[model samples]
Each structure stands twice: as C-alpha cells, then as structure tokens.
Target: MTDPTPLTSLSSALADVVARAAPSVVSVHSHRARSTGFVWKSGLIITADEALADEGEVRIGLPDGSTVAATVAGRDHTTDIALLRADTSIAPVRLTRTVPALGALSVVVATTRDAPSAALGMVSVSGQGWRSLRGGEIDARIELDVRLRSSQEGGLALEASGEAFGMAVLGPRRVLVIPTATIERVAAQLETRGRIARGYLGLGLQPLRLDDGIGAMVMNVDKAGPAAAAGIRQGDVIVAVNDQKLSGVRALLRTLGPASVGRVVDVAVRRGGEPTSFRVTIGERPEA
Candidate 1:
C-alpha cells in the first residue's frame, strides 16, 4: 500500500473552521415520565426533532457566560428535523453549497455537558439515512466519530474551514449531525408558527397490548391540573381522543396537534369498569 498522507500539516484552513463554529453548538436535556413516579432526563439532541425529544428546560451555556431558554418551535417527522428559539440570539453559522466529502476532518462540541467536551474525527460516511428505532427515516445524514458523551446530543459539528456543516444527533461513540441546510428549512416552518410551545395534560400513561385493540392505561393523574378537572383518574383506559383512535405516543401527538392548544376536546376512556367520555381543556406548557 502507498504511504498515508500526514494529517497534522493538512492546512491552516482547517483550524479556522473550528474556531468560527464551536460557539453556536449547544446541549439539550429532555424529561419524561417513568414507572417510579419520577421524571428522568435524557438527551437525543442535535438541531432536529426538537419538539419530540424533551430537552427539559433547555439551558444554553454560551462561551460568554450567557444562558438562555431554548424552546422547541416545530418538527417535521418526515425529515426528522426540529427548530429551536433562543432569546439572546446567535450569529447564525453560514452554510455552503458544497457538502463535506467523505473523510473530511471535523470537530464536534457539546455545550451542555457537566464539563464541556470536544472531539476530532473524520466523516466516515455522508448522504446516508437510517430508520430511527423511534420510527421515521432521516435522510442526507452525515456519520462521523468525535468521541461523543451522553449529553452531546443536539450539539454542533463543523467542517475544518468553520462553515456549519451539521448538528450532532446520535450513535454510540459515533456522532451524526444532520446537515445544517435541512435544519434551516425546518426552522422556517417554526418561524411561521411564531414561538415554540408545548401542551401538558398531566396524565401518566402506560401502553396497553391487546389482541383487538391498542391504547394507554392511565397510571396517574395530575389531580390539580386539566386531566383531574375533567374527571380523569388513575386506572382509566384511554381508547381514543376526539374520535381518532389512539395507537401509540406518535398517534397521541397527532391527535393533540396544534389545535388542542386551548380548545376543549373530548377524551374517551374506560373508567370504573365502564366506557366514559369527558371534556378537558388543554393547558399551556410551563415556561422553562
């Protein structure tokens, strides 16, 4: 085999890329209900799918000691992309028409780690898509290795020349940042909707498996919130919402949609050993 090229003397150009893009990178944490009656925090960040993944009370720590609330604006499942909003503002990283070639050197940064971490690696693959274990296939994704840590999700990865190439999302030690261009398109959709917000029902649910049906079994209810006010109680089997059958969490999200944000809706559940219906007015998610 021929001798390999020296990496250290590559060029002055590569150094500039890391310096320019690292600041814009961020870390995200999301909270979900668990069987223990407590909330658990996890990260599956990157700029995409911001709405679905709970980056609970996002605290973006900038290099300049600035921390701002990062809100989930919108997400397009077809493309697996989500947009986020920050009040302090950032000098949005610029993009290029050209994509990173295979084996291009890049750096990834996690702004939300217990102690921030950085890694150096090369793009092992590009223009690839994978079906998420969560469902839905993400396309035009770049796969690289930057020695990512647990909280590195939703961080930023940059080309050696500093132009933003993508944002980090997943893998074990391998990192994948969906291309920045795709993120821009989804952010546009979020902007049209005004601000990023989520709704809360204050009910805990467990998936029910049955031969002829699919549903969630209510394990607990927020007694002081909408679910309790509407007569929802633990042990209720939610079979449907507003006429639409509930299949799973994804289906439940669609049923809520954007229209549910302040409107009262009918919820069908099996309570007290009998089928029942109740109307609950959806409530706004608390500001982080």
Candidate 2:
C-alpha cells in the first residue's frame, strides 16, 4: 500500500464519525414500508411524516439489530414530520445549534440494515430562517446537493465534524434539511398534546389579484362552518385577519396557527366594493 496519504486519513476520519453517530440512527417500518429516523429524546424518534404508511403498525429497528414497537405520537403534515414513541430508551443524537455554512461537506446517515448507510454531499444552499412552501415555519433553510434514496428519507444530516445539522427529507424537487429547532418544537408539542391542533375557518379560498397586492377570495363557504355562521359569504374578499393584512392564501393560513383555534377574531372583508368586518370564532380543523 502507498504510504499514508491525506485521502486515507480523510477516509478514516469519516469512518470514525459514522461509527459514533450510528447508534442514534434507526430504521422505521410502517405499513410494510421502510424509512429512517434518529432518536430525538429518551424514547422519541423523529421521521419524515410522508414516509410512514397510513394503514399499518409502526416499528423501529435499532442499530443493535433488534426491533421495538413504536406508536405515532403526533404528526405535522405541513412540515412533513412525524414523531414516534419507541418502547425502549434510545440515545439521542447531538444537534448542532449553529447553521451549517454553505458549500460545507456533510453526510446523510441512515440505518437500513445492521449497519449505517452514509451519503456524502455538500451543502448546496443555506439561508436564514424561513417557512416552507406550505406555510410551516422552519428555523433554517438547508438543501443538500445529494440525491437521497427512498430508504433514506428520514436520515440524519451531519456536518463533517459529526455534528448533526438536522433530519433530511425530500422536498418537491430537492432534498431539504429539516432543522433541529423545528424538530424540537414539534416534538415537544406532540409529546404534550399528541396532535397539533390547528385553527380552521372552513372556507374554500382562491387567490385574487388586488391593486394593492393579493387577497383571498372566498369561493365557497361551509354552511355549518365557522365562516358561514359568521356571515362570511362567497364573493367576499378577505382583506385582513385580526388586524394583520392578508396578502395571499398562505398568509391567512399562517395567521390561523394552533393558538388561534377556538378564539374569537376579527375578519375584514370587502363585499360589493364596500368594506365589512365580522367577529368570527375560529374552529378546530377537522380530521382529514
């Protein structure tokens, strides 16, 4: 063999990082499908919500080659995350507080079999906190320049130093890193409430162009829903919610967070060229 080379040294270091982080990575099985997850807390595992099958039991295959039963504690489909409570204790991975720099080397680790699988890639994009396309708040926006396999949807993303950036999920056209802050916040809520309670107005809305910008046009109203009871009729343009200007459909959705449910709020609308307002009671979102 050639004398010790820098390439060899780098390979050795990567091996060590994988060895140390593999214990926290797990294979999640739901509805006869397999994905990945990492231990979040003592008995909680976080995975991509979309990867889980809707009709079957959930289980976790640990790194030690044993499997344990798991239950879906809660899921936030807006962010595409799900929390599972494992029957046995687990070693949670160390999450890095700082955002990873752009173009930095990173690895995605998954526990599909007895050993961990890793994919090396660079941080293709990193930016300040933002919201997903669906209106879910994310702490940091990160995208990896790696094509993730179907089995690695919920794997852990780590920096070169073995510090975890977050969990990886496939977005509409790219792979996204679901930052640790989002994970922790959603996990805590799931652990406490077992579900995310979101407020709903029960109106089918479409975006309409306004001279100022954009507004939501009420296309249909549920006769028995909150909006209908508040006299919000079709053909009305919602201008604002609780004093916040409504620019588009997403803005309205963001305003109706979980805390807004079951609370009375003012809705400003324009009907027939005249401005009107209604005091509407926000209702809990119905099950899908």
Model 2 misplaced regions, further than 4 Å: 1-3, 206-235, 242-246, 259-266, 279-288
- Model 2: how far is 231 from its true place, Å? 5.3
Residue-wise C-alpha lDDT for candidate 2, range 219-246, written one tens digit per residue: 9998989999999999999988888888
Instruction: Please give the CA lDDT of all the candidate structures.
Output: 0.59, 0.87
| TM-score (C-alpha, index-matched) for candidate 2 | 0.85
Question: What's the C-alpha lDDT at position 34 in model 2?
Answer: 87
Which candidate number would show the highest TM-score if scored against the true structure?
Answer: 2
Using lDDT as the measure, the top candidate is 2
Work out the TM-score per prediction: 0.51, 0.85
Model 1 alpha-carbon drift over 4 Å, by segment:
1-15, 29-56, 76-80, 112-116, 128-137, 194-288
User: Which residue window of length 10 is worst by lDDT in model 2?
Assistant: 107-116
Work out how many backbone clashes candidate 2 has. 0
Error of 2 at 237 (Å): 3.5
